[model samples]
Target: MKLLALQGFLLIIAVEMVAVLVHQQHIMLWAAGVAVAVPLAGLRRLLTTGDAGSADGVPIIDEPGAALRQWLSGTEARIRWSESTRADWDRRWRPTLAGRFEVSSGQGRVKDPAAFAATGVMLFGDALWPWVDPGNVAPAGEDGPGPGRAVLEEILRRLEQR
Candidate 1:
């Protein structure tokens, strides 16, 4: 609204300046007509613009999954994977991943680490599973889409796929 007023004011000022600079009466009339027509066209466009909202008054791309995907991708870059901090990652992210979607870790003792690893791989993919093993650390600088971020992204993709 303020922009429209400002533009109208500027157009009027320009028309007046042009009128003052030129003595010819016909050019002055043409200048005034142009100034009025331009603002009227702009006003028509503004008034005719359609509502972006649906009947529910909601917008597309506003889902929780979109936000989660962005967060997971951003977090991947900040994580500096190191051999010394294996326990920290396990304690921090394991429960987070499990509790995030409210999935149970299943019953009793986890007898087979490979099967457990496979389950994590299936859910989160190979990017996260190797980190579960004490010996496996993702090679440094492999945090691009094919690995680190790709791991969590695969999970988000599957979730959104539903």
Candidate 2:
């Protein structure tokens, strides 16, 4: 993530430098436009691209990416535990699961460990919710499976049905 941010920054700087070298005010404006547009485009893609299924219905888990598939599987397994309380849930679970996933699947380590772990925990929470509270219902935005929780929920549902 840091590398991506740095690369984006550098790309912006490069565009600005080129605009300056050309002495084009319009080009500078164009550079500024790109500077604003690229990240927003990325953000949009991030926000829109993830799973978008409702918790009331079955979630789709058709991700073709092997690493992502494994991550989803690991997330589902971690959440099925009922004996462990949230306070007692181990923080190391994410990294440990991710590591094992990396090894078994031959996928590389997550780029951002903290972010990955945090996401894993969120996924775990979502998956465990149905088991923890059968009557509990997810809210509108909260119910849809998206890149963050959605993908995990979908995978968990699939696993549970299996």
Candidate 3:
């Protein structure tokens, strides 16, 4: 995504340079317009539809009010949320709607200690998991019992019982 953006920007610059070299103000204006419009169109699409993932290059988790449940019998996954970290995964991936979604680490391998240890070293070195929603606009407040809050509560309850 970053590469694409860079390439588009370069193309725009190239177009402007060519226009300047030939003294074609009209053509230069058109090129400039296209250069701006193309990226803006892409940005609009991203904002309207919330599917932004770097690896996949598309929105991964797209369901509204969606909750991801990962059962890690051996090792845990790391998660991060937009509201807490302010990392803006969405913006980095999709500039229009950059900070609208969450990203998380996948359930890693943990069947064997030696092998798991090697992989675990890499996994643990990465970011945190279960990047939950920041409970934005929850009438109950940040810690109040909203939908996401309820889900977290249930998960905690289940973990405690286990």
**Cα lDDT of all candidates, in order?**
0.55, 0.50, 0.43
Query: lDDT of candidate 1?
Result: 0.55
Per-residue lDDT of 1-162 in model 1, one digit per residue for the tens? 467668987998888787887766667877888888888887787668733445564634468789888898776643532222434444444345544423344511246655655655665556555543333544554443223444445554653453
Give the winner by lDDT: 1
Give me the runs in candidate 1 sitting further than 4 Å from their true place. Answer: 51-162
Model 2 CA deviation exceeding 4 Å by range? 51-162
Worst 10 residues of 2 by lDDT: 81-90
Number of the top-ranking candidate, with TM-score as the measure? 3
TM-score order, best first, reads 3, 1, 2
* Residues 1-162 of candidate 3: C-alpha lDDT, one tens digit per residue: 565577778878988998899988878888899987887777677667764675667647556544333333211222222222234322221221112221122222333334433432343222221222222223322342222333334433433342
Model 1 is weakest, by summed lDDT over 10 consecutive residues, at 100-109
Cα deviation at 120, candidate 2, in Å, is 40
Task: Report lDDT (Cα) of residue 102, candidate 2.
Answer: 38
State the lDDT of candidate 2 residue by residue for 50-149, as single tens digits: 6344555355666579888899898666654312333222232333334443344332335555544344445445554333221233443443322334
